[model samples]
Target: MATRCLRYGSLAFLVAQDTALVLLMRYSRSHATGEMYLASTAVCCMEVLKLCVCVGMLYAGEARGSISGLVNVFRREFLEKPSEVLRLAVPSFLYLLQNNLLYFALSNLRATPYKVTYNLKILTSALFSVTMLGQKLSKRKWLSLIALFVGVTVVQSDNHKSDSDAPHPETGLGYQTLGFLAVVAAAFTSGFCGVYQQKILQAGKTNMWVRNAQMGLTSVCLGVVSTIVKDRQAIQERGFFQGYTRLVWTVIIIQAVGGLNVAFILKYADNILKGFAAAFSTVASCVLEMAIMHFRPTATFLLGGALINVAAYCYNTPGRKDGNKLPR
Candidate 1:
């Protein structure tokens, strides 16, 4: 009973943290800074933080024998059979592209619209699971996916209409188009990376924290290079971290913590739980945007959100006991 309560508590906290991270990303873009490089730098910092935490926990709890023994084992796994780590790290590095793209999308779109559109990842993940894991989906699952796509389309159409009425509508379209494309790419990459991670996890005895740390290291390396290449001009002009305020730092910390929580969730929960968390976070984001930003949701947006929620529930809920093996 206590264990179950703790799991539920962690799940709730994860949802809140995820919602806060999204809101903070939007706030950072709109208020403190618009530099994607700086944001990427924060993400690199997050990866480092996760690595350090994972190492600390491993040494404190999971490590056996002497410190030297643990060190030797680490050396053996990382040096001798590096391919095992690379198998997960490579896909993780690719996933960082999706994360960076999400930041770009959040900067361009309003929080509500962004959340609504991002829910499409659920469908993308299902498709990837079917193709990559040889999992089969039921007819009802396909219908739910279709419903989710339709709901997203409706919400996006409403957002476009709203954008057209605003001043400088032409500029809005340019940004919206870029943002939409980024989000689509992010969704596909997210699905593939998730399926790949699950495959790696099931294939070996590698520690979850170790895998996370390796992926973090890979992301930090790639993120540093990408940041330098992409933000050279901005860094030359304004210096790195220039325009960083307290709120910006808050966002960075939230992002780091969120990443760690995700690693934990991936280790402990199934993909359905992850999808449900993302959907719940979307609802929470809409509420947060309304309360914090004084944004009003359109009737169409609400209708779309309701449909998406229903679809998400239908898609994730188990139809039969045998279906539980799909996420594995």
Candidate 2:
């Protein structure tokens, strides 16, 4: 009973966290008046925070509150076995790239469109899972993937507007093209990064917290490099935290903690349930977009959302022999 409760609770938190993060990011990016916060810097800070949290978790779990023991374990895992840390470098960099893309997508697109479009990652992730992990999918999985692809394409149809159709307030800045492109790239990266990370996690019985710390450490280094490379001049003129507000901090905190929660979900819960949680989050974001962002969803967008939801159900559900249904 306790295990079932934990599973359901984590699933619920994931759905809520995901929905809130999407809505908050869209609101922060589209409605801001003053100097906008740098997305790269925000991503960098999130990585640092994740690393700190993971290290703390590792210390608590492995070191038993002993500072010396913590140092020794950290040294053995990170410093002594350098190769293990290097193995995570690819996924870490890809994750950082995907995050920056999400910020870009949310900045230029409304919450609803971005949320629907980002579902393409499901298709992409499945492809990689089959290829890299040698996982076999049933006919429903393949069909669902195709349906998801079509659904995302249909969603992107809303992105392109005729001159007759006036641009929405969220996209008045005229960067919708770039926004859609960034998210498409993000979807690809998400697919590969997820499979690669899963492969690593299954490779050994290494402490999950230690592995997270390694990825976070590598990600922090890459994030800092990216920040300096792209935003060096901006940082020089304005401070690192310039344009940051309470809302900005809220978004960062959500992103940082949301990643950790996902790891927990994967550890304790089923992926099919996780997919349903994602679908629910997408639905919640659609409703919230209408309420908070004043978004007007077209018939096409609603149709796309339905297709995507069905596709998520198909893709994540096991074959007929394995009986598991979505929660009531």
Candidate 3:
């Protein structure tokens, strides 16, 4: 458990750092005409780094003869049971959608309101769990959900300051309202993906390594295809070697390491838990951002963040039904 906690803590740290760097760098490039191309290249670099890290982690697991012991688990299990492969891949694809869409939305908005509105994800995730996964939610979980709503409301109120006075985009009510909905949609899809991923993981004595390796391959293929479809020239222009600075490349590498741990956690645990992890990781990132802002956090911001953390913890507690059901 100590190791697990440490691992998660480190993952959170990396995600927080990566997000901060991405947001800040994107902000610097916001006025540039090639924003989309820049963003795509940046995202691709991060994905490639993630692919490498996943491979390394899989190898490490194989060396320990644990989760990756079945290096040939693909041939033995998936080749013989193609349906199983499809089952896992299906949820992972959905997860990929949820992730990319969320990032897209985030890139479009500034970090403050984005942070405040993102908490709505927890509510959507629970709804997806209850409706699609047929998972039961304890009364405590419901209360926590309510707390999350209130916390988000408070944070939103804090985020309403005039953007004219600020350096970044002011995030008006209309944009935030729309961003809120987009984030909600992303969260719902992500919640469903989580429940389904848990189902796939629990289906049989499957080798987690092979499952991840295939997922890495799938992500690279699908990501490359999608990126090409969106802007082929943009991708090629931002050659792998020329697209990023040394510091940015370092950030991408660290983000990949963090992402690998997150993927492993996803394989073994519930998806709602992963959502909570992401949400809390956002909070951690927000705190880090606040510190970087070099201004004192208002009482409202601090209290609201605390509430968000509480809600996340309540949702993450063991034996608490995450409100998702799996096929028995």
Candidate 4:
């Protein structure tokens, strides 16, 4: 019963965190203050927060006497088998790349369109799970993925129509193409990184917090390099954390918490569950926007949400021995 409660609690946390992340990103990008943020810097800030959280967890565990003698376990492990840490940390850099690309894509696209396009990552993740993790999916799962794809495409088309109705509609084909490519790349990286991280988690008994710290450290270093290469001029002129209002800080905090939560979810669950949580979060975001932002939901959005939920059910239900049937 306790385990079940934990599972449900974690799922709820993931959904809430994901919804908060979407809303914060939308707010930051559309702020009227003309505040522009560098993607690399944002990534760095999130990684720093994750790193701090991981360290805090380690200290807390020590205080509880759960990891009494393992105070320097991370350092000892690295010194003993640096390659192992690198094996996990290097693949994690893909997450940083994906996250930065997502920021770029969101900057170019509206929130609804971005979420619709990003749902493609679910299919991408399933593909990676089959190829990289050597997992097999039933025909029902495949059909569910197809349904999800169709539903998201409908949402995307609806969003495009809405975009066209806007006064300052973005008509630049080049910009649209670039945004699409960025989203696609981000989806691919998200899939690859998720599967790779899962492989790492299964390879050893390393604590999830320890792995988070290693990944966070590696990501922070990469983020620094990326910031220097990509946003050095902007940083020099405006300084780090410039134009960071309370809303911006809220976004940063939400991003950090979400990032840390993902590591725990990945450790305790699989990519499929994570994907479903994201799908639910997308729907929740639409509802929240309707209530808070006064955005009216279109017919397509409602239908798409229903279809996506059905797809999630289809994917999660067990297949029967006689045929590709959903669970009873």
Which candidate wins on TM-score? 2
Query: Could you tell me every candidate's TM-score relative to the true structure?
Result: 0.87, 0.91, 0.71, 0.87
lDDT of 1 by residue, 1-328 (tens): 6545545666788789878888887766654324333656666666667767776766765566368765865686667877776775677677678878887787677777887888887888888878887778788888989999999888877754343223222123226767777788887787777777777765667787777766776777787888788777777887877666777678777777777766655655555566677888888898888898766888998999999999988877757643544333
Task: List per-prediction Cα lDDT, in the order shown.
Answer: 0.72, 0.80, 0.59, 0.73
- Residue pair clashes in candidate 1: none
lDDT of predicted model 1? 0.72
Residue 171 alpha-carbon offset, candidate 3, angstroms = 16
State the TM-score for model 4.
0.87
Best by lDDT: 2
State the local distance difference test value for candidate 2. 0.80
- Residue 80's lDDT in candidate 1: 80
Q: What are the per-residue Cα lDDT tens digits for candidate 3 across 88-178? A: 6665566556556554555454565565556676687677768866678878888889998898778756754333223323222225455
Candidate 4 lDDT, tens digit per residue, 100-136?
8877676666555667678788889999999998787
lDDT of 3: 0.59
As for lDDT, the candidate ahead, 2 or 3, is 2
Q: Runs in model 1 with CA error above 4 Å? A: 1-9, 33-37, 63-70, 160-174, 320-328
Error of 3 at 104 (Å): 2.9
Report model 3's TM-score to 2 decimal places: 0.71
- In candidate 2, position 137 carries an lDDT of 73
